[model samples]
Target: MTKRRALLSVSDKTGIVEFAKKLVSLDFEIISTGGTQKTLTDNQIETVGIESVTDFPEMLDGRVKTLHPKIHGGLLGKRSNEEHVETMKKHAILPIDLVCVNLYPFKETIQKRDVTEEEAIENIDIGGPSMLRSASKNCESVTVIIDPIDYETVISELSETGNTTLVTRKKLAAKAFRHTASYDALIADYLTNQVEEGEQESLTLTFDLKQSLRYGENSHQKASFYASSIPTAFSIASAKQLHGKELSYNNIKDADACLRMMSEFKSPTAVAVKHMNPCGIGNGKDIYTAFMNAYESDPVSIFGGIIALNREVDAKTAEKLANIFLEIIIAPSFSEEALEILTKKKNIRLLALEMREQKDISEKEYVSVLGGLLVQEMDTLVEDETTWKIVTKRQPTQTELEALVFANKCVKHVKSNAIVIANNERTLGIGAGQMNRVGSTKIALEQAKEQLDTAVLASDAFFPMADSVELIGQSGVKAIIQPGGSIKDQESIEMADKYGITMIFTDVRHFKH
Candidate 1:
């Protein structure tokens, strides 16, 4: 009978000594490298070093130790082949039955505030990834472990059955490949960003699973939540769910929309989102007024929608929020009274997230299209009247200007062919995802009703023709704001002048599809 051999080399020493002790108890010889050897030997567990197996000392700052053929041939050889066993006997190579290895902490090191290129480059692991790949490729005979969380399960199975099943080995092998692949991707993305001129032709993205949802957008589909590996303060991935049921796919999408819309305002703001579009948004002297204004914008649309506010939710605001059947409510914090009032509703989800200015964590956005991907830089540019071009005879009044800015912010989050009509920092009506500009205008105006006379409209993009302007003018809207880049821009401006309306061109277009 021959003793099975296990190789253990890990940067994270979590539960390694106990796991090694379990293998020793199972009559397995443990071979380790560097700190792993030191820790195991210190814990009264017998272990052999890589220097003994390869017959060479670790050199070149500890990079050349595990690249020897003796180490790799042992991991890559097949036990099913008679010729493989004969060759191992001829070369004095011992087969490695199990490999426990984890790569360097490149992702965590690069996340520091002042990490340099030299520091990041030095943290990239070489021998660790090589060993993992070799062992994973020969998973028919070798078991590979990359995550420390799986140590207890693997140990328990080995102790009970004297070996891991083939199915468990295959699954662990797949996980090992993904672990090394993600580690390499982080290094690739970091180096590419160092170039000052242009971006890399290909995109490398990595996300860690935050939680698995009960289902996707539909109950029949599967779903899970993934957070960007890059760190940032203002993301749903990092939000804390203070109470209520688990989040669904639709809840996450709508909550993100509400947060983006809430980021547009400096004052106390509240935004209500439905189906990934802003149904109502408002700002006021206090968060209570903001909540009521946004809720009253379109009460029917706000039902079952998610609400996000920029300030701490108070008892008054929580009372109003609990009045309707809502899906989720997210804010920076909740007052004691507010929590008491809102907690009464057992099923409504309450999330607490401190809002911050969103820095460019990743400057690019990727969308899958058919067989390939479409990539573009994120739209983080802030647009205001500083670069606006007012194209109408009657300039907007002070009050109208404020309303126009608010409406523009609300419109940016709406789908294409979107129209948002607002008054006194509160959205009066919103028409989103329409086929044509006139159709959106009619829906927004119809929803505003008597408020149309004093309400202002914001277009997400330029109106190609004058039909939308004429439609809003007939509805008695006093002011309009849009991006003016159309060939018939003069026509739209003339139409605005004909009806004695104020029109401003932001020169920036925000088209969200």
Candidate 2:
């Protein structure tokens, strides 16, 4: 006639008092340890101390508490097996009907601005995961809860049926294992980071679900968004949504591309992105002019594109942005008037982020393949201007030099076979992801049209043949910037010299695939 026992120990003690009180009302005894015991007792809820059941003092700085056989036996003993019941009775062990446990704040501790190694190591929970796993392993009889979000469901079922249903227990057990697995993966990743680079033999990836997208690239494909465990303040994942409808998968993609392109300039810059390609990028003394320059670069493409500005958005820029049917607008902050005007459009999304360059941290990029992943360092390196060589006999003028560097930076973000034409520090035409270099050049040349007389061209890679340079010569491009590594480089250099075009070789290739 003894009541069933429930073990409750949690680092995140959210709603524990009410849960324990509900269990007590349903004829259950609450056994707790450490801070959890203090919290429940402080709330005037009677509880059984953990040592009373284990008969062993929590030694080694409270690390050796729940790893005892008494706790595990209570959780893992089979109720339907006669031999298991006899062994449990012989050992004087009680059956634990439920377990509610959550691990320590290891992720939160590591994310602190100045957290030390010892601080993070000390927060790794040992006994908590053991108890959760033991109970989850025998989930037919023992129910386990790892998240506070599931507490109400467990309580509701227990209140109605006097115990959790088999289906409910199975789901909670599966979740408990996943919780522990993710926690362990985070620890593994942290330890791997502590080691020297290239010493890690295994990859441990951990991410938390940020949201479930309405759809993926297409409406039929399901998708979700996940944020990395390590914080990135400047990234789109860290952005805070302030207004409008939910972000789709395509919106997140375009916004990420826009932010990455925006990081290339230190001035008040604006970037317009569509389909993961920068259609327009502009820099100026102020954000409004920067946005105007970007919009004017390609008005048709910027109509429903993602816009990212490095500086805070003002009412004037917001007014112009509101006039366009933009999918999203991201910035450091928005003026009160700007928000009032922009928020009137119910379908446009606004995201605010810290526009940090993040140069100090060596960030990484991951791409998924069919059965594995590809990891590489992010392409944030700033090529040395001193290393550039002027191969063309006609040296570029100072004005052409400034515009060439701007175009060089802009071209690196474009896809392969990319060509970016710019004048006065703003893109006039961009041709990306074409099949051949000549095709991209033709497309960019056609877009540049009248502006080709003064525009400078930047290609993501060197021309394998002189055909692209011959094509550029046919247009009136003044100067060219490319990562000249092809064996036919001299042919292109001769072609540029014949056309009186200034060509510079950067040596560093920026191929984005």
Candidate 3:
């Protein structure tokens, strides 16, 4: 049997000494650098320093250790080729059969509030990625391990077969490449942010793979979850699933939508989502009342929908939720009694998302388009009596004004071009994702039917054409709230004036397509 050689370099030393001892027992020469070499040597396992093998010393503050051609040539050379063997013999370079490397903890280091720019830059690995990539590129000849968690399995495989199989090596190489890619992305994003603080042109995003889902939107497609390198206040990707089956693609999408909506409310709120749209949302004195009100909004649509609560779920709410066939329930916390009650339903997915402070107001909203993504400042503007401008002859009552504000809040969360019709505190009708503003207004009024006579309408954006105003008038909507900024705004105002309808301009558009 040929004498195999394995190089090890890792920031995480968990299980390293034991692994090195096992490899030594199997007669494999252990090659390592710096701290890794000391770690193995201190454990009484013989190890050769990488500098000695390369006939070069580590320089540039240990940054130039593993970048030598001898190290790469050993990893890249093919054992079966006579020409490669002769070249290695001519150069007097030993073959490296395996490479195990994990990158520096740049992410962990930067997460420290007291970390300086110099410290963050120092954590960016140079020689480690070069060695990993060189080893992975020649996976047909060498095994590359990027994660320490896989060390035991690799050692077990080698012990059983005397070598890692080709399939295993290929898998490990793919993992190594992904690790390097994620590491590089993090560094790039950090540098970009440091260079350009407030400009949209300088925005850089890096997302790390969190978990692979069961499937995509459909059973045929594949899907995975990626979390942003920059942490957010309350992200579904960061949430912990306490119990139940794996989340499907649809579940996560709906859950995220619901969570974003719930984040807007300060009171105890509950939102029920179906197919990435809110079926029901209500705020009440307590979580149980909120959930009950949301459920009562549309009980039929709540079936098999995802439910999210902004407050801790109590036993009363859990019992009510258990009676239905919901897909998932996300809340800040669940009482022990609530968990016991909910656990009786075997298929419901439960998640506990710790609430954090709201994100900074400056974070822009992003939406994916055909070829690129659209980024704009988030619409955090809210309407009050001072911000509302009444431009029509008719006046709104206090109750109608309150309903208008509530309906406007609902419209902001809906897909554009959207219109919401509500009376009192309950939504009477919602038209979302329509082609035109008029079309959405007509749909909302039509859904309200006779109730449109007294219901207040809230539009996400200004009506470019006066047809929407006429349509609302024909449907008997008494009052309207809209973000007025269209060039043809005067035409819409005239139409509402002619009908003697009450109109309030919020002056802030919320287009959420």
Candidate 4:
């Protein structure tokens, strides 16, 4: 058999010298370009420049080096086919048995502060992706390596078998394709942001596989996590799971819900999530007390729920959490003792995330339907109190006002057509995922029982009809907070006036689904 030919071009040169030396000892010819060739030659390893093999000089400042027909003819040629072999011979092209390439650091370039548009555009690689795709498409004959961490494994397999296995080549080819696709996505996203203002074009999104779950929402379905290359605040995709059994689909869903809720508060707060809904939420003097209050709000609901805290986990809080049979715990930080204690429970997932400012209130929203996705701007900001106009004779008391605010915050996180009734900063009843406004109001009041008479009501959106307002008055709710954007707003206001109920128009909507 003829000696195998290997092409090497990489931005990260870690362990390349030793790798190339071993390849040379094995009688594989090394072909590289630019900085990669310089590094290998300086290390006393004989190397041939890619320009020399292609018989074409690097042009456009090295961007046109590997795009030549000679490089691609070698990578794409099929060894088993006589036609392909004859074509390569007629073109004076040598077969490339292996390809090792990594793209330019577009992510690093875009992350730099005050980076110009020119700088970002320059980092987009042309030749690198073309070479990677060419090699990956011919995985039946060529082995492609993209990640540097796999260098040792590839070398070991090659040494033991005298050639890279087909299975290994296929796996590496898949990785290379994913790498190039993600790179293209980053470039598209960056350029899209530079377009004219008020551009309504959809954002091009791409994500890499993070992990596969044991199952989806149920044991019968399958699920997997895909993380974006673009970072976001309170991202579960970036979370480091310190300990646990493999995270299930439900665990990840609830953890994500808890993280989003906890990110909304500036003061120390804790939220308990179960089945992608907030079971309990509270703020206190410190993290420990806050967690205790949140747990007490609905202990039965929190039995196996996920907990997220905005503050660091201390030993005291950790001790209390350790006593519960919880599924997951997430916080910005955890004390050394706390982590040590928590890790003892092998089945609980503990995640530590770097704290960041809450995502922009105007970020895009997405919902998955049976066939496609529904996209809109996230309805995040609650109505400012200054804009609220009381349309009734009765005014809410200071305590009732505070309770209304708390209830509004809770309702914002609930599913659309939602109502939350609260008293003394505790959620007395939450009616969520309902079809109509009146149905939600009835469910909330019925759940609150006797406390419904004294509690304040918060609606996620405006009452389309006066029946919702009348329903609240019949329950003896003292104050009502709503966005007040319905066409029949006058009818609702008149109904509130007749019932002596204090109603405020916020001019902001909080629809969640």
Candidate 5:
């Protein structure tokens, strides 16, 4: 009887020798190439060099090693077909019963800080994916393995039954295809980032399953978190949870919002988020003062909200945070005393993040629609104050200009039609997600009823009519900042001048849906 054959070529050689030894004990002949062959022979296990089977030398720096017909014919031949049998016998192609292959480290190579285009292209494996796909397509006749974690399972079945079971073959084949698809996806993403411009003709997205959530937006829906192949320092996917219960779907959304909001500030800052919108935001000299100002910004809305701080959490800050019933607290790090106190709340999530990974230039944002996906660049273009056009007769006071900048940053992250009223670097009231601009203006003005004096208002977009500006002026806000592109800009300017309020046009709009 002819000995069953197994081909092995892998980048990760975790247990290749042990797996090959087990196959040899089952009367299977091992076939390998390059480093894999060297490793097996060094372990005193026998292996048939791939050149002996292909009858061709590896050329083009090992790029042309496995493209020969003899290697593929053996892996692709239909064992049950008489025509296939005749062809194999005519070509002297021995049937291959198993194939194990893993692609080169393209993902890892591109992740390096100094990786160049040439280095990235060199790591793209051409022959590996082809073998895995061909073997997976004929899973009934051949078993395919891409991960070393499955070595023992395949070895166990072969040791007992002399062959992998049909079910195991089918399962491993599916996993192998997924492995190759993700590898190809990562390579495509790297190439696009390097040279491709604008939207591509096709969009390919691939992510690893990071977690399985208990529920989606609602308890009845199922959901899971898929992390991007490339890791970022500020991403919620990369955050390390020091203590907490499992994060829910809403918790992740709120935490992500808090992080984005916190990224807008340079000083020690605190951002509070609720229902995927900013409820309060504040900047201060230290973390403790920042938390206090954020809590005071909207004390009622901060309950059960997610809070993210740019600075480290100290004992003083943690003590103030402990008084609030928050769902999550995110920072660069936590003090020993701070962690000890916060850990007492068993259900709150405490996360530590590397705050310096702000690679804004290459960042992309993705949103899933009904049947398709929408992709765009992240809204990270730094707002330029040099482009501001003061349209009103009165110039803004120095204090009001600083307040307007702070209010503009907070308003940019709010859902439209959004309005933010702030003073002294702390948000007094935030109106978000209203259908009409004036309606949102009313909500913010009412919330800041007593704090309106010397407060500045920021609008995400130009007001369609003068009514919103009229209301903002009536609320005693001293300055207003907005993107000025609407047809009715003159009417709002007239209203601001009539109210003796300063209006500035940023010439850039931030519309968050």
Candidate 6:
């Protein structure tokens, strides 16, 4: 009987010596290449060089080592087919029972601060993927292993039964394909990022599973979290949880919304979110004051919401946050005393992020439809007031201009058909996702009833008709701001002029779906 043969070529040399020793103990001939063979021989484990099997030396800087027909024939030959056995025997090719291969650290290399395009290209593995695919294609005759964590399991199975089960081989084959696909995606993403204008017209995105969540938006729906392979500094996927319970699906979604809202302000800002919409948002002299102002925006709606702070959490703010029934709190950092006080709430999830002065936004945003994807550039353009037109006769005061800009920023993140009522950099009422513009105006007006006379209202888009303008004007909305692109813009401007309401046209629309 022929002794079992195993080929090992890996960049991550984790537990290779012990695994090879176990295979040698099982009466298997260990065939290895380059560093793997050197390590195995250094550890006194018997092994044969891969060149001995191929009858050729590794050349072209180790790129042409495993593309030989001898290696692939051994992996792909079928033992049950007599013709394949005859062909293999005629070529004097011995069957390889197991293949253990892992690619180079392409992802790791590209993450280096000073890495160049040429360096990234050089790290891409060629022969490693070829051998793994050949073995995976003939999984019924050969076992393929790519992850180091599976070494013990394979050793245990071979020790007990002298071979791996078909089920195990199939599962490993699936993982091998996933591994290669992820590797190729990383290479593609890196190259795409380096391409200049007019060179490539599309982007390739890939996400690796980060973790399996308990459920999706609802408890009954299954879900998992996948993160971009390219590293980022400000994404919620990379946040470090300092204390408290694991974040749920809803918690992550709400936290992301809260972060985006908070990112709109340069000053110390706070945003509270519930059900993927901002319940409250404010900027103040300090983070604690900002938190208080945001909480005051809507005390009832912020009860079980997530809070995001753009500054470090101090002891005073943490004490205030502790009193509320918040599901999550995300901040740049936390004072030691603040962490001590906040950790008392065992169920509240706490995350710490590194605040960046200018966060990088990806160019494309994808929304999945029934049978396709709706792709668009990210809505990251800054609204320039210099480009705005003051259509109404009355010019807005400095205070009104500040309030209008603040409200406009807040409304940009709200759902479509949105209206936001704000004053002094604080959101008083936000009506979002309404079917009609009048309905949203009514909701925001009612929420800011007490402050309507002093508040400025911001409409995410032009009022389709003059009814929305009439509604806000009658409700004592001191000023109004909108994109002003509707064909009936004159009608809305006339209504604002009639009511002496200051109106400005940004000439830019922000319609969030």
| TM-score versus the correct structure, for each prediction | 0.96, 0.97, 0.87, 0.88, 0.97, 0.97
- Which portions of model 3 show Cα errors greater than 4 Å? 77-91, 197-206, 229-233, 360-388, 394-399, 446-454, 474-476
Candidate 2 residue pairs in backbone clash: none
Residue-level lDDT of model 2, residues 1-513, one tens digit each, is 979999999988989999999999999999999999999999999999989998989899887889987899999999999999999999999999999999989999998889999999989999899998999999999999988899899999998988899999999999999889889999988877787557367787778899999999999999999988776777889899999899999998889888788788888999999899988999899999999999888989898899999999999999999999999999999999999999999989999987865553357789999999899988888889999999999999898999899999999899988999998669999999998999989888888887876799999999999999998898888799999999999999999999999999999888888
Candidate 6 local lDDT, 1-513, one digit each (tens)? 999999999898898888888889999999999999999889998888889999999999887998987899999999999999999999999999999999989999998989988889889999999999999999997999999999998999999998999999999999998899889978877776687433355545678778799999888999998877775667788899998887888888888787777667889999999998898998999999999989999999999999999999999999999999999999999999999999999898899997654456544667889987777877777878899999999999999999999999999989989999999769998899999999999999888899787899999999989999999889888699999888999999999999999999998999988
lDDT of each: 0.88, 0.91, 0.84, 0.84, 0.90, 0.89
What is the TM-score of candidate 4? 0.88
342-425 per-residue lDDT for model 1 (tens digits): 999999999998875555433566788999988887665678568887888998899999889889888888998899999977
- Which parts of model 1 have CA positions greater than 4 angstroms off? 196-199, 361-363
How high is the lDDT of residue 244 in model 6? 82
The lowest-lDDT stretch of 10 consecutive residues in candidate 3 is: 354-363
| Superposed Cα deviation of residue 82, candidate 1 (Å) | 3.3
Q: In candidate 5, where is summed lDDT lowest over 10 consecutive residues?
A: 354-363
> Which 10-residue window of candidate 2 scores lowest in summed lDDT?
354-363
Candidate 6: 10-residue stretch with minimal lDDT: 196-205
Model 4 Cα displacement at 108 (Å)? 2.6
Give lDDT tens digits, candidate 4, residues 65-116.
Answer: 8998789999999999999999999989889999999989998899887999
Q: Which RMSD does model 1 reach against the true structure?
A: 1.7
Q: In model 2, which regions exceed 4 Å deviation?
A: 357-361
Instruction: Per model, state how many residue pairs clash.
Output: 0, 0, 0, 1, 0, 0
Deviation in angstroms for 465 in model 1? 2.0
- Residue 506, model 4: lDDT of 76
RMSD of each: 1.7, 1.4, 3.4, 3.1, 1.6, 1.5
